[model samples]
Every structure is written in C-alpha cells, then in structure tokens.
Target: MSIKLPDSVPLHRGLIREFHDIRVSDVSSSFVSCQKEIYDTLMFFLESGIDYEDLCPLVKSNCDTYIQLLEQEEESQGFQTKFKTIKENYKEMTESCEVFDLDTMDRYAERDITAPQLSKLLKEANDGYIPKIKISITMVDRILRAFPYIWKDPKCILPDSLLGDGFNNDANEDEIEMAGGSIELTCPITTLIYEEPMISKKCQHTFDKSGLTEYLKNSDTNRYMEKDCAKDGCSKKISMDDFSPDTIMSLRCKIYQIKRNENNNNMKLEALDVL
Candidate 1:
C-alpha cells in the first residue's frame, strides 16, 4: 500500500513497462518450471516402479466429475506429436504467456470492475498513473494457482463410471498419490532457486522477492484481506509492509551456487578418470 511512485507520467510509463516485462518473465518461467517439476515428479514415480495412475488419480473420488485432459497439442505444422517431451510443450505455451491476455490486463482496474483501465491513464506522459494490467493482479492469482499443482498428485485423471474411487474397490495405499516433493533448493512458489530473496517478518519464511511483493499487492476478490505465509503448513500473516532484504540469504545462495558447480566439475573429472 505504501508504494512510492514518481509523479512524472513518462517515468510511470517506464515503470509500467518494466512491470509488464518482469511479469511476463516471471509468469513464463512459472509455466515452464511448474510443468517441469510435475514432469520430473511423474517421471520419478515411473522410474521407481510406482503405479502413479492407480495410486493418485487426478481427481479424488466423491468429488465432482470433469473431463480428463491429456496433451493433444498440434505442432507448427498442425501435426500432433509425442516425440517431444511434455516439458517442451510447456515451453511452447510460455511464449504466449499460457494464452492469458496481458494486454487486457494492461488496461485493468480493480478485478471487480469490468471496464478496461488502460485508456484511463494519460497517454501523453502527463500523469503518474500506472495501468492495472501493468501490475497484473490477475498474474499474481495465476502464478499462485499454477505453482501449487506442481506438487500435488494428479487427482483421478478420468473419473468415468468405471474408474470412480468409490467404484474401484481394489485401490491401496501403495497406489495412492503422495504430497509435495524435493527438487533441490527451490522456491515453493516458482519451483526455482531463490533470486532477490525476501524474508517474511512474521514467519521468517523466505520467498522470491518479486513473487512475494505481487502476492501481497493482489487480492483475488479485490477486497482487503490478510495473506497467510506461503510456506505449505505455516499460517502466519504475511504483509507487504513487513518484508526486509535478506543479505545473509543472498550470500548463502552464492555459496550454494559455487558448491553446486564444484560438485558438478568433480563428477565430470571422475568420469574422465574412469575412461
């Protein structure tokens, strides 16, 4: 709420442009990383000989039914192909920002208002007003929804008359889906390593700084409400006002990068020695 902005409309325009660019980068990365994480998870399950499909149906039984989804994407030539991995398709989706209308947001006001807000701001660089799509409350919500599914087990994918959990009496614990996973030291929200980290004053939990800022700024209902900590099980209130730059975490992250590189080099050296 205490966002400081220069009154120059030209500056606001630059700021707004920067906001949109950063958002596209953030959102595109989220789309790729979330799918990549989920892909790795399922691949891990398959390699471990786990029957992921039987254990964790995309939908749980006793829930509302919906159509099952599988990747049926057509390539540039309009030929659907499975030769490319699912991760590659996710990358293709990111180029379009997953089919989201960022420009429509470029004109958004509050989510509750239906009118486009872009034209409301001065186009002549005479006022400091920033467009709502430039800040994108929609993006904040989209990122929030996209990241969580990476860790959740696919609910029963197709809940037809034959496959409902209630109808399937043979399902067992070994076949049931598990929650969350480990993928190195990555942000829970982005599923990537930390960049521009911020520590939550309330819970001491850390999140990518840009992600946290957006989360605090947007409300799904466009009404004031407190946000809980982003950590999976933590419930402490998180506010934009309570964040502090984390220099220690920054230094520690550098150390992590160096160590990871060193270990990678060592593995390469050992492989060469064997040859």
Candidate 2:
C-alpha cells in the first residue's frame, strides 16, 4: 500500500537546508566560542603567575584553524568538493525516494559515529589539550526521522515525523485490503507458498530456500565461481551464505495465511445460508 504525500518536496528541502545550516553555520560559530574558551584558559593560567609559554602555541594554532576555515569558505577547492559532494547527497534525498531504507538508516547513524573525530580536529588545532566540540548532527537526525512515509518498505516507527497535515491516517492496513493489495505468498523461483523463506541480503529479494540453493548449485559455475542470483532479472553474485531467513516476511506470510483461512470459512458459511 502506498500513500502519496502531497507537496512533500518543500518540507523535505526545508529539512535538508536546516540540517546543513547546523553543520555549516552552527559549527563555524562554535569555533569562535572554542577560541574564546582557549584564551580564557590561558588568561586563567597567566593571572596565576604560572609559566605558560608552552601553551602560547595553542593560541596561534587555534587562530590559524579559524582563519583556515574562513579561507575555505572563500576559495578552497578541497572544501568546495566536500561541500558539493555532501550537498549532492542531500539533493538526492530531497528529490528521490529510492534511497530510504534500513541500510541507509544504518549509514545515517554511522555518519554521526562519535565525538572522537571532532576531538581529534580540536587536538590538531592545538597540541591535544582540547577533547570536545560543542556540536551534534541534531538537525540531520531530525531530517532523517521526518520522512518515514517516504521509505519503500518502512521497518520501524520514526521517533518523529513532519507534515502531519499531508498524511492521510486512513492509509493503513484496511486501506491495503480495500485496494486489493494482497501480500505475495508464493516464491518466485518455486511458485510455492512459503514454508521458510530466505532472502538475499544484497537485493532484498526472497525465494524458496532449498529450491534457490539447488538451482544455484546447478547453474553455470564451478567450485570457485560464484553463481549469479537465481531470482529473475537480478545479477547479484550470490551463494548460500548470502541468504538469510527473513523473519518479517515469514510473519507477513503467517498473517496472510490466517486471513485467507478466515475468508474461506466465511464464504463457506454464506453458501450454506443461501441453501
């Protein structure tokens, strides 16, 4: 069942802009605060009449980093490339629905992996005294969470969503039934309803486990050669190890089976009533 979100592009574009605004402007602003903190630390040391000559390098180093950042914003090719590449990625997310999925969610989380990289940058700007950056990818996180309805096969509930006005909440399980969007029960390879389905990790296509394994074994390949996936139109090189039991698909099949049985019983009772 698909729900078309009316006018989703503007909201999505806004979210992307907000994310980059945090990444670029907020982080850039934090650099100034960071520099002040460094100076304040040095001032604290000097007022105590302590020998802080070794720490003077940190001030110059921090200033250099701040200036380098300004220069990058002005004309650095390296910075331009980085900015362009990330902007292109965001552009795709705003304009295309093809990339939203579990794998991309994993990647989004990986992008904000830790404070270590920021700490390392601060250390590079100094001589390893700083251990933090007062920044997080909060806007990016919000953008990713805001578009659950856009996912091709949504696997989890988003913590939050945007465009509450655009969503038709009635586009639910009952909508799927009313639209005759029956769940696929049969395996493409075996033409049999699933008993235990195994899915290809790379392509997300499912097939009958034993039938797929046997077909792959008999394909045009030897011991060293990996067989192309048996699923029609898919060319992903695959082996038995590449397939795994899909619990969610299995659960869907079970639900389909139960619903089908109930429907058949209702038809039988109606036939008896007609007599």
Candidate 3:
C-alpha cells in the first residue's frame, strides 16, 4: 500500500539548514580563536626582540614623565592650600606692624634665619607678648623650606647587559683571530683607542692614564681638592689616588694597535700590487 507524504514536510531541507548554521558558528568561533592566537604570538616576538638597551630609554622617558606630572600636581595643590593662609597672615602682620611695607617685610621674612632663631621667635609669639613681625618671619621660613627644590642624584650608569657583550659575536673565528682575539676597546673620556689604560676606583670609567692625569692637573685648583670624575654624568669626587692601572685593558690596547699596524701594512702591499 502507498503512503501519502505530509504537505508541510521539508524536514530534509530544515535539517540541512540547521547543520549548515552549526558549522558556520563553529568556523567563526575557530577563526576568532586563531586571530587571537596570531596576535598573541606576534606580541610575544615583539616583546622578546626588545633588549635592555632598547628598553632603557623608554623606561627613563616614562619615569621622567611621571615625575613631572607629580611635581606639577603637587605645586598646584600647594599653591592653592598655602595662598589663603599666607594672605591672611600677611594682613594680620601688616595691621600689627606699621613699620614695614609688604615688599620689605616679605624680603626680610624670606631671608635664611637660623633654626634656633626660628624656634625662639615661634615660642615668643606663642607667649602672646612678641611682635607680629617675628611670627610672620617664622611662617615665611617654614613655607620656603616646605617647597624647596628637591635634588636628584645625577650619577647614572648603564648596566652591563645594556652595554652589550664585550665580544663581537657577529665576527667569525677567523676575523677574531686576525684582530688578535681582542675585543674593541675605547677610552670612556676621549672615545678613542685606549693608551695606557687606567680605571677610576669610584666610577670604574676607563681612560688613558696620561690624558686623565693631565685633565686632573688642569681642572683641580689645588692638590688637596677632590676632582670630579671625567666620565660623563658621573659627579663622584675622585682624587689622584682613586685611579689604578688596568693591566688587562692595557694589553688589549697593545694587541689592537698591533692588529691595526698589520692591517695598514697589508693594505699598502695590496695597493702596490694593484699598481
């Protein structure tokens, strides 16, 4: 017997459509996951490529920006907080002390007063018989000291990692052998080949011994006075005794000079052969 099919029966098409939708959703999810994976991988490679030298300036810039912002914010806050107090105090002091004008009073108040004098004036003011001028001077001194410029240490050095590996890894064994197996050496002071290398005990900056000695002799007014280190950004006071001969560095310089002379001779011979 033949069975009649239902008129609404598109069950095959519906099943196909449902399957297609599920597949599309799965594919989209997988594509998004793959894109994220690719981004993460790229970021990892980028981050890995940044060596200490590359990162140092960026870190310094960020620190400087942070400090500037903090200082500005503090200054704005301090001015706003102190302005009213100062104005009120000035008015009261001027009313009590008719002898001094605002400018004169301000100049006198801001002068460097000893700690003992400040304490005595504050105590006398507290006892209620002292003149208002003394109280105003103490207040001015406190305000000036409170907002004094903070001094940051100027001495900074690059870490060994940032200075790079002393050896030229890119040069093959043959090139290193030709160069007498000595890494490139330069004086920190003159940025030239080191001659009679001497290292500073305080900063460890290498310089030509004679050059450094000459510089010290010229810069120092007296033998007893401490000399500022010749290295850039190093403010450490170095005496004549703070320098020592760097024997290994001196040996490296000698080897480098020998290699350079050999290279020069070879170049001259090659030029004669070409002629």
Candidate 4:
C-alpha cells in the first residue's frame, strides 16, 4: 500500500509549487512586519517632543533608514509605497519651518537709523511718510506729560527708560530736583531762566546778586554794584546804573522782601555786615 494522505497534503510536482507559494507569503509577511517596526520606531523618535538639537541626529538617522527602505521597496506594490509617500510629505512640511523676527536696538550706535543704507531707507520712508509706528495710549500720555518738561533733540529718539529721569545726557532725575531746589524748572532749550548770577561789588569781593544787593542797601557805607560772570563766553558787566531800585533791593536782601518784612531784624543785620 502507498502512503495515504489527505487532499491538503502536497504530492509530486504540485508540492514544490505549494512550498514556493508558502515561502513567498512568509517572506512578504516578514517584510511587512519589519517595515511596520521601522516606521513605528521612526515615528516615536520624531514625535518625542525633545529639543531640536538633541533630536536632530536621531531624526537624520531615521530619515536615512526610511529613504533606504523606500528604495528597497520600489518594486513592491501597495502599503509600503503609501507609507513612504506619507513620510516624504511629512519631511517637506517639517523642514520648511521658520522662526519669528524680533526688533532690537544697538546702543553702541548714536542713531537707530544709521549711515549709508539706513540713511537712505529713512529718507525713503520720510518721503512717503506712511507713519507705520504702533504705540499704546499709555505711552502717548506719558510722552505728552514729558513734552512740557523735556526738550527734544532733532535727530534723537528717547527710549521709555530714559523718561522720568532728567534726559540731557547728564544728571539723574533726583540731581535735577536738587539743583532746581525741589522744583523742576521746565524751559525751552534756547532760553535762560533766573537763578541768581554771581556778582562782585566795588569792594572787589564776590557775592551772589542777592548777597551783593543786601550788602549795598542796608549798610551805611553805600558801596557800588557791579556784575561779573567768571565764565569765558560771557563778559557781562553789571552796575547799579543798569539795574532798577527794586532789582537793587532784591539783590541786597537775602530774603525776598516778603520774607524780610516778617523777619526784618536778622536779614538787616546780615545786610549791614558787608559794609
């Protein structure tokens, strides 16, 4: 008796064909499994949410592997091609990313709008004058308040940090207050306001205008008045003839007349001593 076998059992020439089909099917299944594993691994590293610097090398390696796998599967039909296409699309999307731009100032330069190229741009901008600047209401109000006290330079723009402090490139807000004697003397850049100028009397010793005037009037000696500015640019000479009686009296009285009237004796004695 020949060996008996079920219909499912391979026999003679058909057996080899059956074995070849089984082998091909198993190889195809294993290739699908390998491709799925590689895809999953690449996706895990890509989506790891790590810093770009740390992930860059891993991403490059994964991409190289993916490209190689795609080349290998060029003859294959269906799923592999679809996955490779998805990855290529993803690479295109990711590699096109960009960073946002920010505005910053270079303090070393005197002007924000600088020489040559920048000057040309500014000229062009001013010619058209679109006024593209954006500012908040609070900033406008603050600048408006400063406008009366602060003098602006023709070519300079003041930063917000410099405002509240005195802004002439010298002295802080507190020093300005001290010099003005607790008042902020706001004035246009070109004008001079009255702070007493130093004067020397005919006696030849120097005193401030107020000190000299008080000495002249209260003292019985009747010394003459003279104005002198020690500075190189100014050579103004003051005399009693050039000034009014009230100006003379104001210069002589250390206290304003209103204050002197209330405490006349002390100021009168001080005024008398210069004689």
Candidate 5:
C-alpha cells in the first residue's frame, strides 16, 4: 500500500515552512513551543512511514534556515536563545517517557544479560531523585507508550530462530565473482543513450510509439524499443536517433512510486494535469 499525495503539494516543504513562520512571525521567544512542534512533526513523519531519503530534502532546508535564525538570535542581546535548551528538554522528556514491561525485561535479561536481578538493581539505582520514585516510573511508561512504533521494521521477515543471521538469496554468481575480481571496469556504457523523451510533431504523439516499433522491427531488438522521435507536426517516420543531441525533448517524466490515498475509496482526484 502507498500514500497518494499531490506532487505539487510538497507536504514536508509546507510543514517545515510553517515551523519557520511561527518563530519569526508569531511568538518570538518560546523555545519549548518550537521544541514541541519539532517533536510533533518528527512523530508525524515517523508514524507516516516516510522514508529517510524522501524526508531529507525538507529537513536539510529546514536546518539551513534554522541555523541562520539561531545565529541571528545569538547576536541579538534581547532574544532569548532557547533552541539548544529546548532541544535538551525534549530529549529529557522523551527519555523519561520510556515504557517497559516486567516480562520483557526478564526476557531481555535471560537472552542477553544472564544476571536479571543485578540488571533490575541497576535500573532501580536511578529511582531516588527530587521528584521522587513514582515520577521516574511514570515517565518511563510515557516514553514506552509514545514510542512503540520506534525501531519497528516497516518491511522485514521474521527469523526462524530466536537469533539467526539474515541472508540475501537473490544475488547472482557474476556479482560475487566481480566483487572478488581485482580487475576494474570503469568505462561507462559506450553506446549509452540519454533518457530522451521523444514527442511526435504529427498525430500529436507525445511518446515515440511507432518510431520505436519501426526501429525495433528493423534492428530485431526484441526487448527494448529502438527508436523515438520528437517532431512538432510531421507525419514522416522521424527517429529519435536521427534527431540532434541538443534537440532532445524536455518533456518531464514523473514517476509516482508512492501513493497515499490507497485506503480512501471515496476520495477522487479533481485533476491530473498533463501537457
């Protein structure tokens, strides 16, 4: 299942922008608020099953904007610099909220530590703070409840044994042989063709269907289509291979590998703009 969101929406981009807007445009010195927002956003993303690669661009942009703002705050005497302090408070909050079960603890001890009583005693040592014993345990419970999804694998196979090695069965022998070989092949594919989207001028053809078909037919290229063309309005059999390198069509190719709206049967797309 995949989530369907508009490519134009830039979901993460907007969220990050909102965070920045709050700092400069709204409340100026509330570090805790900012920290909470950040935490909430992180939690939202974590729960949404967004991969790190997709989230990185927005995060990188956010960090760049944040660092500049923080630097400015540091220079201003009146501005209360609270980013670090707030971040630490957030860390502390998350740490205190850790949850654990007695059964789970015992299981961990049996599997890894071998000294269950000693491990329990060590955990107990951090109990006697000024806020008292109960508060720590409460926080631990909160942490556990809030972060149950953490460290969960979105896709993984269960091991047969309690402890077993992961294996990849899909790897081929040539891959293994090449890895072991000392000889290096650095040259790129000599006859490599750029991913040039060919549009036909005639029949208002956007992709080179017939041209590719004809090229393949001639070359006996059974697997891959061999020809593509981009002529504005000509009916002639124009081949992409014949087109000048610089004249390659700039038609955009968007691949929607992830879709967010799988569950919402009622929801409908109002528009799917194609040029």
Candidate 6:
C-alpha cells in the first residue's frame, strides 16, 4: 500500500498560528518595533511554500496601508518636519561647490568615501560657510521610527539558513569546547562550509565571496531585480561595493576544516586497529 504525504498548507497554517501567538501587539507603534516581527513572520510564510516574487506585491500593499495609517496620525507631523529639516540640510551641504570638488566627485563615484571622511567634510562645510547645526536625538529617533514604513518592500527573501538568526547567533564557549573547539561554518547559499568568506557591508551577513560574485554575475534575473542580501528576510540591497574579504572568518573556517579532517582520519585509524 502507498502512503500519501501531508500537504504543506496545514504546516503553513500551523506556522501562521504560532506567529500570531508570539506577536499579538497591534501595529500602531513605531515601524521599527514591528518591522523585524513582520519580516520574521513573512520569512516563516516564505519557507512554508510562498513564492518570493509573488510575496513582493503583498508586502508592498501591506506596507502602503500601514504608511497611510501612520500618515493620518498626529505624531507623523513632527516626523515630517524633522525629515524635511534633514533633507534640506543634506541638500545644502551637497550643493556647495567648495565642498564637492573633482576629488570628492571621483571618490563618490568609486564609493570610497568612508564614514570619517564624510564626517570631516560635513564639519568643514558647517564650520565657516553654513550655520552650526546639530541633528537632535528627536530627529534621529523619528527617522528610525519611520524607516520601516518607508522601506517596507523587500525585493526578495531568500532561505532562512542564509540571512536569519542562524547566521548571526554564535555557539557558546562551552558548546564550542564540547564540539572539539571546531566550528562547522556553512555558506547559506552553497550549504557547504565557508570557502573564501565575504561580509556584506549593508547587513554584515557572510557568504563565500567567490560563489556570491559568480552567482551575481551569472544571474540575469537577480541583476534585473536589483539583487539584495539572500538572508531569510534582509532587504538590504547589495552590489560589488557592499562586500569585503572576511579574512578572520576564512582563517577560522580553515582551522575548523582541518580539525574535522584530522578527527575523521583518527577515527578511521582506530577502527582499523580494532579490526
């Protein structure tokens, strides 16, 4: 007699139930507070069988609805004012010919301007030419509070193994020691232990740099879609400028691979001796 496997719909319903149970709070507060929760819930749904491309429209609709609700609120007025101020200030700073010369333009084109360099330029622009200005905590808080509403639609959500808590959470020292102090690091994309790891500047997610580069180069669909991080629910857009060689992770992976090989060899030798 043949046995039938259960359909995924039931499993999906179960996960949805779990999601609602965990995040029962109304979505009336700061978008940041609920952003991670929404992303997590959506990721669960995606894993349960939802298509990534199809989910984009649903996500956009929900986000738009939430944004409309937020816009109708009294608090959003203050947020708008602060956003305008920052926008004006940034515009003024950028428009100054003295501040943005050929060298600055070249660096901007190369995406080589680091945080300190930008800070220094801002300081220079503000010191003599413009009135001394300080960005208040209220403004910063308001921007962060509204960011989730503005940046709601993610291009794609990849597998959980790629960009979720699984990648960020490290094993405890005790666990590491118990596991012979050898970590098994896998690339979320390749599902293999790390080889030539690269960290994303946008999300800090690590992947095999060469593998990612090749994937990006070859994938016309992803390139057209403006490929972002493949981590479970991360929406951070990525490009060649976003990756950096993760030498530390590479070294750790090498050590772990070597240790695992040695252990396997020793196990085989012991079994041979017994035989």
Per-model TM-score versus the true fold: 0.30, 0.34, 0.32, 0.20, 0.19, 0.32
Q: What is the per-residue lDDT of model 2 for residues 1-275, given as tens digits with 9 covering 90 to 100?
A: 85332322222443665656533332444544654554455335334432223434543454455445434433333343445445555455445442434544444344422112332332453442322322232322222222222122222322313313323334432322121333465787788877788977666667787677666774555333357776666778887777888544554454345445556777899999999
Q: Provide the lowest-lDDT 10-residue window in model 3.
A: 146-155
Q: Please give the TM-score that candidate 2 achieves against the real structure.
A: 0.34
Question: Which parts of model 1 have CA positions greater than 4 angstroms off?
Answer: 1-184, 219-225
Clash count for candidate 2 is 0
lDDT of 1 by residue, 1-275 (tens): 55333222211323444534421112434434544454445334334533333424522321111111011111111121221222244334334332224443422222321322232322322243222221122322222222223324212211222222222324322322224422224556766777887766555566787677667665666543468877777768878766786433443354355445556777899999999
lDDT (tens digit, per residue) of candidate 3 on 36-90: 4433442342245344334345435443543444344444444434443443453
lDDT of 3: 0.44
Query: Which candidate model has the greater TM-score, 2 or 4?
Result: 2
lDDT of 5 by residue, 1-275 (tens): 85332212111333544534433232335533443454455446544656545755654554444444434434432222333333344334433432334533544334432212322332453342222111111222222222212223211222222111222323312222122332111111122222443433333233333434444355553554424333233335544444332111111111111122222322343332321
Better of 2 and 3 by TM-score: 2
Q: What is the C-alpha local distance difference test score of each model?
A: 0.41, 0.47, 0.44, 0.36, 0.32, 0.47
For residues 1-275, could you state the per-residue lDDT of candidate 4 as single tens digits? Answer: 65322222112343435423421112345545655665566446434544434544664665456445544443343333433444444334423422111221221132332222323333554455232222222322333323222212111233444243322324222222222233222111212322353323322222344544553443565666454533223355755444322221122222122232435665677889976
**Which structure is stronger by lDDT: 2 or 3?**
2
Ranking of models by lDDT? 2, 6, 3, 1, 4, 5
Deviation (Å) of 224 in candidate 2: 11
Model 5: number of backbone collisions: 16
Ten-residue segment with the worst summed lDDT in candidate 5? 248-257
Query: Runs in model 3 with CA error above 4 Å?
Result: 1-184, 190-192, 218-224
Provide the global lDDT of candidate 1 against the true structure. 0.41
lDDT of 5 at 48: 66
lDDT of 3 at 153: 13
